[model samples]
Target: MIGRLNHVAIAVPDLDAACAQYASALGATVGAPQDEPDHGVTVVFIDLPNTKIEFLYPLGDDSPIKGFLEKNPSGGIHHICYEVDDIVAAREKLLAEGARVLGNGEPKIGAHGKPVLFLHPKDFNGCLIELEQV
Candidate 1:
């Protein structure tokens, strides 16, 4: 149902500041910030050898990340993404297993330009799970 870990998303209060910290301190390669209007976020990805780390912040008043940051001022890991061969099939299996899918239970194109779906955090041991079709 799940494959390799794709990337870990971190919600931050300041997107540029967070990217600067990673670029300066860790000397990591940080990609350009891309605004996702549909998702209501401005994000930047830090590329790594094995996986990427996404740093994102709210782009609008009703952004989900905004609420997350309100609850956690310092920001934190928002979700962990895992690769799936077939997102629709994986979603069906998960639903059959009593797992709750977030959003409209439909796969939306994610930051990586792949179909992705988010699962309820409570259903996955308090950790939000993102399934990205690989």
Candidate 2:
């Protein structure tokens, strides 16, 4: 089962501009940009009191984020991550419930260095959901 809200991920065409807006206009604390080649994204985290906002940009032409940006030129909320106590158990439960898991149905190392899995957007009311083990 899902736990606390981990972070909301937003795909942005321009990573630096997005980070600058959050840091200056919103007066938020933006973390350093990190390249997650495995995930094909360059990300920056905006720290918040309760949760975090993740800014995602395409790392290469083949990056999934690039396709997302192509569909949404202005960029938008890419996914919402929720914490899980045990990813394997959670995956099994969701699978048994008929929910579709994305990408080979296996957990991958996320931006936080935690095991993460992505669920099909249609399965979760048109919003991509990420489950991260905490």
Candidate 3:
């Protein structure tokens, strides 16, 4: 049902600072910031050999990341994304298994320009799971 790890997302209060820290600390190529208005986050991806690390900042006052930041203050991991061959089929299988899907249970276009769906954190042992069709 899940393929390779896609990316790990970290919610940050300051996107620039996070990106700079990653760039200097990891010495990795950090991509430009991309504003995803639909998701209400401004993100930047730090490329790694095996996977990517996404730094997300709230885009608006109502952004979900804003709430996450409020809770964690310093910010922390928000979600982990996994690649799926077919998101619809994956969603069906997950639903049949009684897993709770977040939002409308429909796939939305994600920052990577792929269909993505988020699963409830409690269902995955307190870790938010994002399924991205690759």
Using lDDT as the measure, name the better of candidate 1 and candidate 2: 2
Candidate 3 per-residue lDDT over residues 1-134, each given as its tens digit: 79999999999878888888888986889999999888888999888999999999999777889888989999999999999999999999999999999989999998888999999999999999999999
Model 3: clashing residue pairs?
Answer: none
At residue 21, what lDDT does model 3 achieve?
Answer: 88
TM-score of each: 0.94, 0.95, 0.95
Q: Pick the candidate with the highest lDDT.
A: 2
Q: Give Cα-based local distance difference scores for all models.
A: 0.92, 0.93, 0.92
Candidate 1, 89-133: lDDT as tens digits: 999999999999998998999876889999999999999999999
Instruction: lDDT for model 2, please.
Output: 0.93
Residue pairs clashing, model 2: none
TM-score of candidate 2 on Cα atoms, chains taken together: 0.95
> How many pairs of residues in model 1 come into backbone collision?
0
| Candidate 1 Cα errors over 4 Å, as ranges | none
Model 3 vs truth, CA RMSD: 1.0
lDDT tens readout by residue for model 2, 33-61 = 99988878999999999999999999976
